[model samples]
Target: MPKPRGRGTSAEPRRTVKASSGSARARRQGKAGERAGAKAGPPAALRDRQERAPASSRARPRKAKAATSLAETAVVKRPAAPEKRAAAERPAAPKGRPPRARAGDQASAAPPKRRPRNAKAKSGADDAELSPPRPPELDWDDTPSESAEEVLAQRWAARGEELFQQLEGHGAALHEYRADLKEGRFVWIAPNGRVSAEASARLLCSWSCATSVLVMAWADPLVSGAEIERIDGMPAEQDGVDEQGAWQIAMRAADACNAAYLYRVSSPQAWYFLALDGLTFSPKRTSFHPGAPVGLVLRAIGEVREAIASRAEPADVVRDRISALSDSLFHQARYAYRDTDWVARLDRTGSCLSHLAKRIPRAGFSAIAAGQRIDEWLERELALELINALSLIEDEWSLFG
Candidate 1:
């Protein structure tokens, strides 16, 4: 507690100690405070009171507050706040109207206000600047930030992001991770549930490609109407297809394509234009289809004579013929045949095609290059004889199918 100063009985006003006027701090501090008060403007309570005061009193503008290191040393006079003004200072009401009540009178009649929690109360004029502070709980404008998990759950969790599903029988799986909320990006988790940029990207791309292939099978001519039913029967989706599952999808697509293609050139009746469709020296259409041995051999000879006839690459043609005979599908079809003559014909045709495949040049032969540019060596009479022989053998197999 501070010691009380005694007052004289003569009713003299109280006197206080003063700092030396010449002190450097007193001069600096007075100027600093004067500048601060000028920049800050009047406090809210003082502004409200000023607004209600008579215009005449407001006309007499108050001087800026004085500055000093000690608040006590600062002395300045202000026009009385409207709430503190006497009744004489107010403007009179118009005729027939009762005198208007002042804000101070109304406040005096109201209940004393409650103080905010956590804010300490103090006595004195410090209350003029910042008293009756608001509690944080009552401030409705502020928003709270959520954690990463909470953010994902709120925005991106229709189907939970951290999903898991096994891919076929492979050890690899499609899994997930929490989202990156700041950038609004979702990372592709690796097959093993680890974060790896390269592996994850590769997995993502492979899955995308295989899914596209499977979807494209619906549009491919290779897939028959029956195959479309199988596609429809597939499950809606798992968590997400992983690398292994994508491979399996791609394999099914391949099977559909291969199965459809088998009938493309299966028999003599389904003959694809071997080379004669539009490749003759004089391009002309003929209604008559080529019949076995003689007619097929004549078309083959015409193809060899032409410089621009599309020839099947000998290497590819031979491999296909030999693989067909030894492959499972062909073996099953062959087992169905009880006629020894048909079986013997198949064996004999396979041997003939295999012999022709071996005759193609091993070195300096490129299917792509040969197709793009004319093959000078293949124009020879020997290559012509081989091409005709292939046609004759293919004609025989066409009847077998």
Candidate 2:
């Protein structure tokens, strides 16, 4: 029992050895525990417990409901796929059978029957026909007639005038109605048309009472252009004859012409009668004998023959007077004389007279001849005086000296 100091140290060593052995034994036991747990089964850890259960042969059953989210505990139910119904329950026919034929099966099937071709074509054509055509559009920049309608109207109007000119040139009658007053007849010269009786009577009336020579001159062949103008201008003087006679009418017409002549000197055609009337005597161009009775006679009646009776007459006067008288005789002989020899002589004389007349002024001669028409008695008397005077002058010139 009483303890020693050295013994205390020895005991400490032993205690240290013992403590080491105990720590070794403890580590071994721990390793044995880990090996036992591995051999036995999964550990009692959270992950191991959860994974240990058989997924398909779980002991508990899930509730019949729709699953909401994967992370959440909630569950949900899913809808199933739709199924087909029996054919009897459907309204439309089933797919196996062909579709029922149309109600108008005969019309739709077989060969389509054609109507009469003409009738079908006509109906189609009628349907296709549209409204009447409109007028053509005009190109203002390029077309010749900017406004076609206006140009057409102008052309239509001008066509008539052009046709008229063409007809006038070729189809118009060359010789139309010509009145020969001396012959008392109207002659119409046309290729085919007949002259009307009314026109004939009118022409005859115009030509009536004219001299035979005048008729031959105007009606024989082609009438003179101036003569035609005269005929046209001549108005019918016979307007229900009054008691005074034709002389009064003639005087009145003559007076009117005389009055109108003053204003219309430029238009000689208007005053043609002035030269024919004796009231206005033109001055003689050639000088005759002042004292000679022949000159006096010539001045009064414009008779060339009377002028030739004078002695010491101017050469021009004598020549002119002789030439005029010779011309008158020749003109008379042309119609009166049947002999060829006489015709030649008349022609020669007429040529000489023509030359003289050209040189001399004819106004005086025309006036004297015109004066005779003032009175019928005067005309006859002057004509007789002219013949006597001419005869005397001719006899005196030829027989004397």
Candidate 3:
């Protein structure tokens, strides 16, 4: 038992075995770590990420709950509707006279006047010859004095309402006629049936032309330049009396009508009541995606990518620039979650962004393969995605604060 060399020297054998086993385990662990490092690449610092890093990499779970709590507290609240603002604080009356009738009141209003006998008789007449009929000759004692402006306004509105009604009537008649034809019931057709339809159609066309001119006369100059050009350069009909001059006169008349309407009705009231209803009302539902804005920028970047992908050699500079822009947008949208301290929420959004990036090119390429322009489809897809995203944001705004 005197310090045996090969045998146990008290705890010597146990210690030796333990040391050997520990070294073997340490070697195995080092090899495993090396392999893992090779597979995973180098560890990335969260703060050291480039401005345009892939969305997923950038969107990480917050390490501390304090950051999230602060974010929840930091939400910017939408301003409350004012308790009361002076008429001055209120937005200016939509640039014109108020409407003569509210939208809902149209059905109950007095019947509009029919086409003037004078207009029917003249067919085409000079403005001087087509002077409007004088307001019913009234005794000063019996009637309140009306300014020329008021008189003209009243007459124009009456005519506009009449025209709108006539258009509606004609549309209904056309539908009826088509139905009858479909049913094979051509019996007992009146001689004047077709004539009447033709006349109404002509009148409707004329009214539309006149209304367009009238609308432009009062149109806000802020309307797009293209619309202005379309108005100014409208094509002239051969038989219509000095078509250019007639349009000009009609435009001026329209301004007067618009002034009267603006003075009477609110913007929302006018849009709902007069103009849109005449055009027909078929409500369509539109939707926008939550991640669309970033999608568009990504698609545009993809175009750059495809360009880079093409050619005999890669254009690294161009590719890098485009990639940077795409990445920047992706990063911006992803980083927004961080501002809100929604690390968990952002993780999902980042995944969506990455998915969108991948899908854009796939969609674009698919379109190209299907005999469509890839760029065209890519841009269009991007637009749709943006619309979807905006819609989501709007919904969220409503849902949250």
Point to the candidate with the largest lDDT.
Answer: 1
- Segments in model 3 whose C-alpha atoms lie over 4 Å from true places: 1-144, 172-401
Residue-wise C-alpha lDDT for candidate 2, range 77-151, written one tens digit per residue:
233334444444547867999777777995678886878879987887887686466799976776464564455
Please name the candidate that would achieve the greatest TM-score relative to the true structure: 1
Q: Which whole-number lDDT from 0 to 100 does residue 321 have in model 3?
A: 36
Tens-digit lDDT track of model 1 for 353-374? 4565455544444745565333
**True-structure lDDT of candidate 2:** 0.35
lDDT against the true structure, per candidate, is 0.36, 0.35, 0.36
- Show the lowest summed lDDT stretch of 10 residues, model 1: 270-279
TM-score of 3: 0.16
TM-score of each: 0.22, 0.18, 0.16
**lDDT preference between candidates 1 and 3, better one:** 1
Ranking according to TM-score, highest score first: 1, 2, 3
Candidate 2 residue spans exceeding 4 A from truth: 1-181, 184-302, 307-346, 351-401
